[model samples]
Target chain A: MSTTAVVTGLGVVSPNGLGIKDFWAATKSGKSGIGRITRFDPSPYPARLAGEIPGFVAEDHLPNRLLPQTDRMTQLALVAADWALADAGVTPAELPEFDMGVVTASHSGGFEFGQGELKKLWSLGSQHVSAYQSFAWFYAVNSGQISIRNGMKGPSGVVVSDQAGGLDAIAQARRQIRKGTALIVSGGVEAPVCPWGWVAQLAGNRLSTSDEPARAYLPFDAEACGHVPGEGGAILVLEAAEAARRRGAKVYGEIAGYGATIDPRPGSGGEPGLRRALETALADAGVRPGEVDVVFADAAAIPELDRAEADAINAVFGPGGVPVTAPKTMTGRLYSGAAPLDLASAFLAMADGLIPPTVNTEPSPEYGLDLVTAQPRPAEIRTALVLARGQGGFNSALVVRAAD
Target chain B: MATKEFTLDDLKRILREGAGADESVDLDGDILDTDFEELGYESLALLETGGRIEREFGITLDDDVLTDARTPRALIAAVNALLGAGAAA
Candidate 1:
């Protein structure tokens, strides 16, 4: 049985919005969600701005029993998973337990939770620590929690490749479905807004210190400095195409192809792997450069990374050949959550026939690409390629095509 | 100075503060005889509650406190036994 993976539902917990309706609206209109960090006093940090989800109280959406055991990220993931399953019209009680599984990406695992516990351990003693800390701080907590909550006992896993892990997790879910899992909940959601997570992010020196929200994160522009970090992301429901059709599930798009590569050691003088990863994904999807309607760039917002990405796009699609956009400019880079959100936006674009804009960026002419900025463009987007690169040379590419 | 006794009221407050009561389970009604699990306080919840009790009351609870005291009344008795022992010392 040749199984194909298709996206049946999308759950978004974005800095700009809590659900798909709001997220898509904000994306389409190019509204910025970036603002001063209110989760903590940012005065202690160099980069003060971030994209944070507004008005999300866990108690409103989850059970009281779950509050103490879960971190904020896990709470968000559980809610997103619930929304995605509901959007896909999936009732876990009705489905076979072993047929469904969960695959998710986590970059910083329960940092805020760990930070709180560590404070107690230092000030009070080890006996003061909560026993829940043992599993809550694990990177696989999201996947485990989601699986446990839904009673999904099938093949489940968590990918931890930093930013690239989102696409990688979705691809892993696709792989699992192809191997016989009927349905999988996949993608990434992150909440690294606390003081410890902030200091850790600042250590990378890749965060833009710009205080102005509109100009904080500018990818593919001359004024580009560093990317803005943000919280929240997207979760997706992926099902085997035949099973979805049999159940009469609404299809968003097909997860056509995936490719991943790691860049060479910094001083090794080897070429960057972003171009090869994109090419490999296109080949895997049997898509030519001309067939791809749009490219969702990694958009590192650093000069060298931007140059490499532009060169990769230009190398494969040719200069000014395809329209490139970084819709993340509106929501800030969500670390492991970024690419999956872009994937969600791609599916939405195909459905709406409107390409979301990469707001607030004036593309540098040197890139020689047709960059979409400041406004949404109407187009028949059948195939979209999403790219992501992690901190330590992890590069991943995924291709999605409108459902047949 | 006399050590304050650990009571059912204190356990009720800690249960609510540490893990929160289940919506269906009432913390106010006579719950002293109810099992911690029946009150929606699982092992982890009890562990957290014990941690809070230790901090607020300045007492060291044995790790098996939850295992030994399955009900609210038993937990309070165990805590007061420790308090009475400390006062005598």
Candidate 2:
């Protein structure tokens, strides 16, 4: 009797769209959310473009009590959690508060809030800083606040691994469900589109400096430059298989398997680490390479890294044997929130039987993989392989299969 | 750079911004007599409003004013004194 964990609900706060309906429409239409940075003036900055969520006034979503205390990431997380519970048809009155939990992934939490307070301290002295800065800036603050806000008091935790943290958080959610928790709120949120965030990213040397929006952030092209950093996230509800069935909930899919690996120099060392992660995920899911219907490539836009990932797919699945896509091309990369967004799209693809198009991208033939581009492709998507790689060599893969 | 000196109107505007001010109370009358709690201010609202004023005026405000001062009249006096001290300095 295997107790599988199923994705019962999803809430998304993305630059592409706010709620699941809009997100699906935008994703299906391959809408481009990238635009000039507006939160702060980017005239002095080299990296000019971003996937900003416009007109998102925080006060509209949060209570007055939670507003002053929350950072942008936590605020996004809270609203997404509310929507997820609603979509799951979960009423707190129906279940014991201690049976549920929350785990969120964020590589950098409240960078926008912390940077503002730090500026105030330096220029105006410490007295001008908000008292909320202390608890709000910590990465784990999302997990803490979401759990408290909804009374999800089961075992909870936070993942700090880079972009892969998103899938890792969901993986942890599944493990928690198997360990006797009835339900878990699992996903990632990032709001790093701030002045300080841009400045910090400039130091990474991987940012796209193209002034033209259409010409920038190409992931697998002959003229592929670096990626445009973007902000957005998705939160999903993971429920135990039996519990979800008992409630007659509409399950989106199963989080069948998750695998993560550390690669110091994947491109250099025959990149066996990424292959191992993919192989482990397939094995864990009890799936064959032929069973995977589509592949969500990391699409980092770094030439060598992208090629390494392409090569990794060729080694494992035999030269782009499966249809692959990089939907992050539309939203840039959401960092810690990136992979869960991919997972959400994967689930939607399975449910709708149509894989969303990889916007603003056309992969070159040298990649040897069948990259879906320009438009959405209708397919029998049974199993999806979503991949993510963080800045410092964190590689992860998650396999999501359609629920019966 | 010194910002423009604020007026009573500016003070009211800041207080109004801090407030939902949805209640049927007189927002134009002497706010000193009017309770901020009636205008949707919690304990942190005054401090946040005070912070905004200090930044707008490029002046240093006494931190204690956030806790000790409860009325708009008291905050206005404090702001004027800080602006005067800043100009004098």
Per-residue alpha-carbon lDDT of model 1 for A124-216, expressed as tens digits? 899778778988878899999999889999999999999999999999999999999999999998999999999999999899999999888
TM-score of each: 0.96, 0.84
lDDT of 2 at B44: 65
TM-score of chain A of each: 0.99, 0.97
Residue-pair clashes per candidate:
0, 0
Error of 1 at A184 (Å): 1.2
Worst 10 residues of 2 chain A by lDDT: A264-273
Best-fitting candidate, scored by TM-score: 1
Off by over 4 Å in 2: A265-272, B1-89
Clashing pairs in 1: none
